[model samples]
Target: MTLFSPLHLREVTLPNRIGISPMCMYASQDGQVSDFHVAHLGRFALGGAGLVIAEATAVHPHGRISPFDTGLWSDEQVPGWRRVTALVAASGSVPGVQLGHAGRRAAVREPWRAGAPLDETDAAAGFAPWPLVAPSALPAGPGHAMPAELTARQIAHSVQDWHDAAVRAVSAGFRFIELHGAHGYLLHSFLSPVSNRRTDRYGGSAENRLRYPLEVVAAVRDAIGDGIPLSFRVSAVDGAEGGSGIEETVHIARRLAAAGVDLIDTSSGGITTDRSTDTRIRRGFAFHADFSRRIRDEAGVPTATVGLVVDAEQAERLLDHGDADMVLLGRQVLDDPNWPHHARIALGDDSHDSWDVRYGSALGPRARTLARLTASGETPLTRFSP
Candidate 1:
């Protein structure tokens, strides 16, 4: 896809397909954002991303995977997030936040701490990992606590939490909202049979498993109104034997569209104990051709293809072939914050004048000088941001 083409979702127009994926920052203090987050997301906006989804923020404190996770459950978080949204928007990129609940994955150590399970002492200090909740009483891995099955009341409260979070996101100046329903988190736990084994209405059959996720989407949409674009990131397949499969994910996408989802962000795995079984299939290459195409053609909703999607040409081909509406770069963008600028050149949008106007001033050169350098392939380069 041409990085600069407008992507219309409701009233919002993304300036490009190049979006910064929601990578967990784990920099929040007591679920409150700090200057670190503002600088992190704001730089992407300034770097020329058309859209910037803030890291996966929890809907409630207990829903956090670690004590450092951002939260929207309190009004106090809004002001800090607003500071970030304003900075991102000032640079012309749309601001967004991905709301999620970690469920059985909750209360773990930060990624820098190796993301390990904590003990009772750690839990008492507010870092202690404990039994998580899910559709069933299953644990994510060895040494992880087997979660408790959620009651109907708990499920209802969870939906309300998402609804409230959406409202807060909008108030914080976010134009888009994405529910983090993938990666073996709370919503994905319900969607995948590998973790969700309940016989209640929220489990067992595929329809039942999909119910909670769909409800959260509906609730968020209702909370945010039709003017804002709402999206859901889903593990299109569990990548596990007899786990949530393509067909089930497709069905879930269809229902999500009907329930007011603007796009299906297709991701996989994170719901199983075994990721090695399919690691060789070219990471992030699983659903682009088959599942994403099926969902877009059959369900008639735009889809965002994620996972290992980095190369500019590969993303363009996926869009040209009508497989997905948008390509979300995770690690690639992480590795190169200026990926969009490079992609613009690759897609033949190489108006050196435009790119320079956006970035070259930071290089201490006049537009004409930068253009001359770019045309001559003699622009001096230094170490790029990762």
Candidate 2:
């Protein structure tokens, strides 16, 4: 199928294969989305994204990566999300959100400020860092605060939190729900042995590691019900040495599918905060295609691949060659929200007919005007040419 082809997942049908990957904007206040999110997320739908997944929203207050990250932990957050989902749905695009708990990665500064651990200098600015928690008591890195290991009772509580957040996500009008289990987040921490040093049913062996994430899956599925599609993003490989590998992640994907996860959004790395111990995959074009293909084939589940998917031809090639069932773009779309519309032109839709009528109606004539100008050997700079 082509990149513009529809992908059916349970009861949801994405109009095309171009999905906007969840990228955190770090612009909220106390986990409440402001107008920035409405305009930020709404434009992608208008720009022709088939599936628009919101940023990694914390499932619990302590799960936030930064104090400014958005959240679904409280009912008050629902109205803001509802505004965004309604705008996206009006364009026939599937509105989705990636729910996550940052775990040891919680309480870091915004990436622009170097993602350093939040300290009292920020508390003076009224953004006090909170305690971080994880599967183990290990500190995330050199400058990060030591996290408290999650207790058995706390683990049970965390599962309920995910369930409650899923309920909130539905109330917020999100049609597709994706669990952010990748990039050393809470669920990924439990999956990789490097971070999960616990000895209970939640750690050690592979099966033990998968327990908590699977429990979350069941809880979210029950909350969202059978009709709504559920997706899980997995790291597929850990960044640190001796951490979980593709073999382990593939096994995890299989179990996730059986536990009601409808799709595997394949990604990798970020299990460690230290750049020294980091073994992240190279940022090549469509970096996660190989991982996605393997997870799709071996695990017997549909997959969406992300990372450096910059252009339409490259994205279409990924689907054409069976690299993935769908392609997700993050930085590329941020650079140009109408990248999908441009892609349709690049892939032979010269009429711009599929674009939002507001844009396409004007764009089509402009394209013809440009074409005519080009036919007359007139470039914008040609008037000054010798």
lDDT of 1 by residue, 142-253 (tens): 6677788999999999899999988999999999899998888999999888888888898888889888998898889999999999989987777666677778788888
**Which lDDT tens digits does candidate 2 get at residues 106-153?**
998999999999999999999899999999998777898888999999
TM-score for all models, in order of appearance: 0.90, 0.98
Per-residue lDDT, model 1, residue 219, is 88
Query: RMSD to native for every prediction?
Result: 4.1, 1.1
lDDT of each: 0.82, 0.93
Model 1, residue 258: C-alpha shift (Å)? 0.3
- State the local distance difference test value for candidate 1: 0.82
Find the candidate with the highest lDDT and give its number: 2
